[model samples]
Target: MPGNLKDRRGAGRHPAEALTCFCRDVLTSLGVPDEDAAVVADSLVRANLEGKDSHGISRLPIYAKRIRECRISARPDICIDRDGAVLKVDGGNGLGQVVSYKALQAAFPVARETGIAAVAVRNSNHFGAASYYCQMACREGMALIATTNSPPGIAPWGGKRAYLGTNPVAFGFPTRREPPVIVDMSSSIVARGKIILAAAEGREIPQDWAIDEEGLPTTDAEAALRGAVLPLGGPKGYALAVAVEMLSGVLSGAAFGPHVNNLYKDGDPPANVGHSFILIDVEHLMPLEEYYARLERFIREMKSHPKARGTEEILYPGERSYRTYMNRLREGVTLNPSLKSMLNDIGRACGVNL
Candidate 1:
């Protein structure tokens, strides 16, 4: 857990299924197709299940507002241009989840045929989490490298102005019996969404997370929002963010750098976010069984290493999130008081009982 949210409390617990249904209903009421609504709802709820509450249902209000304002199309005329194993998809201002889902569906068969496939998406809104697409590809016995560019929030290597996004990237590798190895992370020191949540909760942010408008460190969430988030490892994260922008934005023919519209604040223009997906079929390189055995062997050896003091079991990249998902599935998803109120408000507006 991030230090900012460690002290937060929940209002109550609710079934993940129920939250999904409510989100789906709210989206459908706003003219989104039932199937598309379900896809976005499931993606958001799964984030919550995996303990990524920052990208979970907390984002629905902005989505709803955007939908009502005609910024995000209810039914996008998504078009795909294919060239060999590469695909370029134009989202037509559609919801990011729906557009990305369609793109992934298109990539699956191509990967199977060519052993590898690349999909570049443009004119999309904010997709919930990159891991959702990684997990989707992993489920089909494929390794995936996925990335998405968001509205600019992070500064360049030596600049104080916000120019690059906290571009998120995810990698997923399948295992025979163990949970898939999933690594999802942002280029910033912390995700900008976490700061947004802190601001919403009226909490002070860690000084390292972001800076004030004058490029000085501050604990005020609002001030941080007005400034820029720090890169994860300074220049290293800035370089990664540049790479992600190239793949997801420049390569996809979408808005990049500061050109991307903000999802929460910019209401006039559509947020033409971009995403890139690379899928590799395991059997293409070697037999599936052989790959699984090699991967599991590596994992076993790595986990068996001696632990430092106060260290418990050493788990793989996705092990912790996988455990959280399982536990939350059984115990129910918890919502903070503000999130609960927000959802309830959306429910009332959409005529759906939460």
Candidate 2:
């Protein structure tokens, strides 16, 4: 990051100032309601601070364009229907992050009462990282799992054509001695948003990450963008992604695969997507203290285990992000040149230059 910030040819703004500026300037330009815009801005900033560059500030241009086109609603009316332990929502085409946050607020009470609760959200835009919402329940000592479907980018097993979403999934649970165990991953070998960022930055992709139209692995970013992302563990990952599609898309009655809207594609309707979240009150299953105590012991054993040859330690799933969060918050986040330029353009258009 030392030399990265010194790379003057790229995004050349301090991370905090850039993120704050982007959130305030771009969301307002899109005509998002002041309250909802605040929520979206906060979530996007957190993504950057957490070191998830793919889901962070890079999305402002696409989202701003969608708003200008009037495809996505600026102030969608979020609705919820309760069905015992489950709640269904129609986002009214609002920003998915805000809609999902509203849904989670409803689910938290239900989970506390019934021991568990599930929320299904349909007719929404990209929600960014699912963990941003799941961490809510984790903070309340609840175990949480969340997922969302996306545009066609992954291929189903036994077929070459893309027919599934990268389908990001996330989970988080309380731990007494460490940061909450929050892990988010896409079912694909690499996240589609990551590829988009790479393409925006004019970088070459690895051959194993995706395949071209002919179904052959490639190192070309343009080819990979038009092709399908490989699965994480072959069929198992494909199956898992489909499961997410069913739970988030079909279960919520939202579109999936090609039916889902592509943020990069203009002249297209919102693809009217959907997503789902699950919350489990750990105290209902087991006492909260006991649950976390056992987790702490488990993490310590794994960390102190003998190293494999030159390896230092067997790091946990989310340990790296907590480290990144601490450092980035102090050192500031990095933005590529293209991303910075887009931010300036958005600022100028919005009449709120940074």
Candidate 3:
């Protein structure tokens, strides 16, 4: 975060396709198989297009660092154990996106047969975005609830020290005549990745987002990174985060809370992050057309309601992100100069120019 690297011009747009190619090539150079590399690359670039910049290609540098350190196995021997409609997966300390993608694929047929299915994954690293998997489920005509435990970045309610992650939970519900409703959110007021991105961009955060080491609020991104992020709504968010830990970490038999290793700080130990997914096959529950009709009617009613002052229009959970994705796909994603510089540096290390 040196002053010289900060670009005052804000950000510059870049083609998503080019970024995906660069990300895939870099991972492949690090010994990741081409197919898996492409999966990770597509997920990262999709985040950028969806306006989730915190989980975008800006993360490739850290992933590359972990791969080189041997903390993340480039060719992990992922193992899956199934019991009826339930699945238990061991990721073998692999990239999270790859592990999660495989887990979802394994759940598809089981859910179709049983009406619902659950997949618990362990020994995974940072997954770019929870919504990515949720969207995949939607494409399979399923409703999915997905959650993941991350390295600690938040404290328990009324506590001063970091003890819980800003664990994210996502829900994807398919609808007729509308984009899938995807509600993807962190238990914290904001995701910790945003603070990391802000620090890398030499920008200050909103004071309410996180606290300093002394448990006081701070606008400094660096200080926030050193401390704990604030939960979404005090006790409620704290409880939600704990629930996510139980579902993703405890149930999956993976690292929970403080046990998860820091993605950047702990280079030697593999981050034993965990993820859980619940998939419900719409056709099995009710006729797909009937379910879609009900959902569309509900959305129409919700959107027709009167809006509060300053509100332009009501939007569904994933509507804005879907719009952003379309616009960015047609145009391009805007990358801050610092991010570009970091990506270029990673490219240089991998002997691939961005």
Candidate 4:
């Protein structure tokens, strides 16, 4: 919690499974099939477990609304078009988690055979986090590079108006002796969902996160939503965002930049957002055991290096998220009052008791 959100928030904890069930029930009631709803629910809950609350259960209400408004299809006939190591997925305007998960699953066998495979998805709604898909690849002893484009929320470097998404890029690699290495980040300084969450909780954002409509930095979350999110590393981030747009949007033949509909605000027409995934089978390159040993050695040497002032032990990219997931699994996920209330309302509307 930040700013006034700390005072206004409620303290409530629930088992992750229970929350998942609640989410599934709501989606199913909205005409989504049981399996599809489960995939979507699990993705959201996993985000919470991984300490990425911005991509977590807070999105349920909006998802339900979109489904109800026919902006997102409840029962989609996802189709695939494959060409050797390349695959194209048409989500049929379905829930992103369900659509993207299917695309990744379809890529795995191709990657295993070809050593490398790529999947491009179009007509998908907002999927939770890129880490989820990358982690899936890691579990199969593969490395993955994933990226997705969203509605315009970030400006190009040196520009004042938004023309690019807070596009996210993620990487994941398997390790035998430790948690998989994962690096997931948005091109913007922070995700747009963080500002939305802050606004929902009546909190203020950090000034550097975004600019107001007048192009001045602001700490107000609402103003940030109305304006644009700043790029993560100025020109560097803008460059990355452009690359992501090319791969996920242009190459996939999906709506790019301002053409992509806003998932949270817009209802008319579908959100033709796009995503791209590249999978490499690590074992295909070298002996799996030998590669693991080398990776472990690298990790050990890095950790053995001197620490910065006041810093504790060095941790790998995904270590913190793995620890958080384990802790939350045991201790349960905490839900703020506002979020809890929204879920409750959704439950009532769906005739499900939470």
TM-scores, all models, native as reference: 0.96, 0.94, 0.96, 0.96
- The sequence of per-residue lDDT tens digits that candidate 2 reaches over residues 6-103 is 45323554656557656866787677877778778877877888888888877877777787877878878888999999999999988878888889
lDDT of 2: 0.83
How much does candidate 1 score in TM-score? Answer: 0.96
Off by over 4 Å in 2: 1-13
User: In model 1, how large is the Cα lDDT of residue 118?
Assistant: 97
State the lDDT at 229 in candidate 3.
96
Screening candidate 3 with a backbone cut-off below 3 angstroms (N, C-alpha, C), the clashing residue pairs are none
lDDT of 3 at 80: 94
Question: Relative to the true structure, how large is the alpha-carbon lDDT of every model?
Answer: 0.92, 0.83, 0.93, 0.92
Per-residue CA lDDT of model 1 for 1-354, tens digit only, reads 323322332337777888899999999999999999999999999999999999999999999989999999989999998999999999999999999999999999999999999999999999998889888998999999999999889889778889999999999998889989999999999999999999998999988999878999989999999999999998999999999999999999999999999988865599899999999999999999999989989999999999999998999999999899999887679888888898899899999998
Q: What is the lDDT of candidate 4?
A: 0.92
Error of 4 at 8 (Å): 24
Model 1: per-residue Cα lDDT at residue 174: 89
lDDT for 292 (candidate 4): 95
Q: Candidate 4 lDDT, tens digit per residue, 222-245?
A: 988888999988889999999999
Better of 2 and 4 by lDDT: 4
Worst 10 residues of 4 by lDDT: 1-10
TM-score of 4: 0.96
Q: Which window of ten consecutive residues has the lowest lDDT sum in model 3?
A: 1-10
